[model samples]
Target: MGAIYTLGNAAANRLSLLLLTLISAEVLDVDSFGVFSLFLMSVASIASISAFGGAATINSVVSKFYMRSKDLASSVLTMSMLMSVFVSLFLSALFSPAIYDIANASGAYEFVFIYFLLFILSLLMAVFSSLEGAVYALKMAKGLLAFSLLGLLLSVASSYFLGAIYGVYGAIASIFIHRLYIALSAGRLAIGKTGLHVSVGSVKRNKEFALMAFRRLSFPIAAASVLAAPAVTLALYILGKREGVASVAEFSIVYQCFVVAIFPAGAIGQYLIAKSKGVLSEAVNVRVQAAKYLFVYGVVAFLGFWVAAIIASHYFHGKYEISISSFLLMGGAASIYCINCSYSSFWSSLGYAWPIFYSQIFMAGSILLCSLTLGETSLEIGFLLGSVSQIGVNIVLLRLTVHEKVAL
Candidate 1:
């Protein structure tokens, strides 16, 4: 039942973003849409860095202490938020120059400040994500779904209206507003509803514990996230350089659809992580159940993609027509990627971060290598190859790590 609500929350979240993508595509020119896509990709990467795996760590900690100590959970949340502030400032300073250069190169220099604003907003979104993890740990998925639905409605309405009037800036402002709403809502639910008290004094006292939590648990996952989150951003950067911004727009559209298709796998993976409780046996069960869900969902999602492709191509009047071959290749990649995620989540639950790190290394390396070698004409091939490489690494690592203890 918790899983069901989590899935619904995932669906609503993805649907909201998809609708915004379509709206942006409809309102903005192809090149502008490409820039918007780049902004979003940057946000994802920045959010991961700013989060520093605090979201997942909070989930694990809060779950472990939920029955034991609410004060500890509250303290962890406060610590994570403090970490977010420092990380976000450091990241903004570190990446701002590079972002400006990218904007100048892409002929979107005027929008650079908006891009920076969005980058800061990503950190706020990260904080929201941590709160959401706490909510999940508390089995408050129903509340999450309700808040997400409300946020979805607000975001869509705001994005559409603002996008039509102010172009990319307005669209981004909508995202800013939406993130604020979600962060506030999640904080309320995690702290207010749960009756968890967080304070500066609590954070001060737990400073050592916070450092230990980050060192022992969050650091490795953060490393893995730092690698994984940049995959799409790097791909887009390469594609924009190799092809043109318009091609980047087209690729972003397909990738957004791909993301929507794979939402179920991600939702399930996160739910498993929240529920697995660091037990290898339970993690194995999670992996198996995830496989079953993915197998059924993958088929339906691919078929849905095909129909969507046809309709989207017609609606856009060939402005964004996706080829059948591209659909098949990307669908295959999405499926393989789902498998990797399911397995990776198993390791994540067990607190074995090296496997996740290795998987990201293989996956990101394959994608970047293929993108550099294959050129724009075969970009989808890069996704396919990357997914294949990731699954291969995941299987080998899983077997080597757990072979003696678990029967395959």
Candidate 2:
């Protein structure tokens, strides 16, 4: 039941994003759409930094400790949110110059302010993401689904109307509004239901323990996330530099399909993480089952996407041309990524973060190397190679770590 609700919420969230992407593609010119895609990718990467694995850590901690001590869990949540504010602001400031250069290079100097706003919003979203993780840990997936659906409806409506009126800026503004609405709603549900309170005093009091938890449990995952999340951003950056923004726009469409394929497995992985109860042996079978399901789903999703691409190509008539071969490559990448998510989540549940970290390193390294060399012709192929490297590392690490009795 929890898994079902989680899957639904994931579906709604991804659908909203996809709709926004499609709307943006339609409303904006190819260059503008490419810039928009770059902004979105940059936010994803920066949000991972702002989160610093805090969401995963909070989910694991809240699941383990909320049953034992609500006060401790509340403290962790409070401290995590407070930490997110500082991290987000700091990273955004630190990266501003680079962001400007990228904007200028991409012929989006006028939209730099919007990019900055989104960057900050992405960090703030990290805070609420941690809260959402807590909500999941508390087994409130049904509520999450409701929130996701509401957010999706509102986001799509606003993005479509505003995007039509105001082009890329309107689309970006709609994203900001949508994220803010979801964040506030999630925060209310999490705090009101859990009776969690956060005050400055509580944050100060819990600082040591919270930092300790973050260092021990969250740092490696954070490292891994930071490494892994930016692969797409790096690819887009390379594309913008080498092949220009039009290629970025085209690749972003294919990437959205890849995201659609992976979201279900990611949702299942989140459910596994929340429900694993910090037990490796207990989760092994569940993880295997999840991998099996993902394998089947991946095959279907890939074929379905291939068919859809064919139809879309015919209908759009080169207005937004996506190479069928590129779509197939991304489909393959998404398949491997789905399988990897299950194993990565299993490792995370047992507090074994290094394996995930190493895998991300390989994944990022592969993407970086490939993007620099092969991205001129096809961004999808670079991503596909990276996905292959990621899964290979994940499989090796999973086999080695499955027998270990890791303490959480």
Q: lDDT by residue for model 1 over 1-408, one digit each (tens)? A: 988998898788778777778888888877778778887777767787778777677787787777887777777788777777777766665555544555554545544564468557878878987887888888887988898899899888988899899998787787787778878888888888686666777777777776766665678777877776677677778788777777777877777778887876777777888888888888888788887777778778777768776777787775765576666777778877776778767876876767777777876777777777885446678778878888888888878988866544
In model 1, which regions exceed 4 Å deviation?
94-112
- TM-score of each candidate structure, all chains considered together: 0.92, 0.92
Error of 1 at 74 (Å): 2.3
Please, what are the lDDT tens digits per residue for candidate 2 over residues 1-408? 998998898888788888788778888888888877887777767777778777777788889888777777888888777767777766665445544555564455644665477566786578767877787888887997898899999988998899889977788888888888878887887888676766666657777777777876678887887787777687677778787778888888878878877887887887888888778666776787778888888888778678858865875565776778887888888888887887778877887777778888877877777787764435677667777888888777666655354322
Clashing pairs in 2: none
Error of 1 at 44 (Å): 1.1
Supply every candidate's count of residue pairs whose N, Cα or C atoms clash at under 3 angstroms. 0, 0
Q: RMSD, each candidate, Å?
A: 2.5, 2.9
| CA lDDT for candidate 2 | 0.77
